[model samples]
Each structure stands twice: as C-alpha cells, then as structure tokens.
Target: MDLRRIKDWTLLPGASIEVRQQGRGVWSGLVDAVTADGEILWVIDPSGQRRLFEKAEFYEAWAIEERDGFHYEVTKNDDNLQKVS
Candidate 1:
C-alpha cells in the first residue's frame, strides 16, 4: 500500500506479492528471498519456480489465494478489490 509497508513486507520470507509485467499483466508468487541490492526473489510454488524482480519492476502488494496452493492476485483500491487491511 505504501513504500515502507512494501519494503517491510517484501522483507518477509514466504510473503506473496503481485508482479506486473510489461505485456503479461500481473503475476502472483511467494517471496523466496531479497537480494542485497533490494531485488526480490519470488517463487510460484505450484510451478515450482523462482524469479527475481527489482523494485522498478514492481507494481503493488497482492491478495493471496490459499487453497491447494498459494496464488497471487493484484489489488486495486479504486476497483474495491480485497486487501489485507
């Protein structure tokens, strides 16, 4: 929601976030780790893969879908989407 919150959240392992790609839209995944350079390493466990994202590549915090596995969905306050608050 905010920079401090994002930074605090992105610091936690296993925390999920939504990453918006240039043309692919949004993707959800768990935070696997954070690099010293402030890059975030995320894992899509269902796909059993991890990817790195820099701060400039980020969009916003995501709402998690918890079922058989975890999935991420982008949040939009304007659209009244669900959020952790």
Candidate 2:
C-alpha cells in the first residue's frame, strides 16, 4: 500500500506502526498521537515513553510481508509517501 492509502485510514491509538528513523534504525510501536501536519508521536518499547517525529523523515514503509506461510522480507520505499493528511 502507498502512503496516501495508509494515511487515508485513520491511524489512532493502539495501532502498531513500524517507524524507520534517520540513522536510528527501525522500531515498532503504538501510535500515541498524530498531528494535523502529519507528524507522528509514538513510544519505543523498552525505552519508556513516546517521542515526536515527522512523517517526512521516514525513508520507506516498513511492514512484514509473508508468502506461503513464510516470512518474505521487510519492504521500504519512497513511493508510498504523500503530502496531504
């Protein structure tokens, strides 16, 4: 799915998201809050509380892809990015 498609679906609390920060690596966390400007605030597990971050900082959409009951790979790309909320 693309960024526009994901953003179209409301991302609320309790939703799991794979965040790939610049030079910080990837992590999965619950979405705490989302800004009107598309900035996402979430908490990293085993790290205490949540942190604020912008959506534009993400290099790609990270998600688990499974095929034939086996783990395929973690995908990333810029094609999923969009400007609107």
Put down candidate 1 lDDT per residue, 1-85, tens digits, no spaces: 4211243333446665565555243556677776655555555645767665665665443434332233334466546664232
Q: Please write out the lDDT profile of model 2 over residues 1-85, one tens digit for every residue.
A: 3221133212444455555556344665565666554455554554656766566666322322211322233344455433222
Where's the lowest-lDDT run of ten residues in candidate 2?
A: 63-72
- Candidate 1, pairs of clashing residues: none
Candidate 2 segments whose C-alpha is farther than 4 A from its true place: 1-5, 8-10, 21-25, 44-47, 59-85
Q: Provide the lDDT at 73 for model 1.
A: 46
TM-score of 1: 0.48
lDDT winner among the candidates?
1
Badly placed stretches (over 4 Å) of model 1 are: 1-10, 21-25, 63-76, 79-85
CA displacement after TM-score superposition, residue 75 of candidate 2 (Å): 11
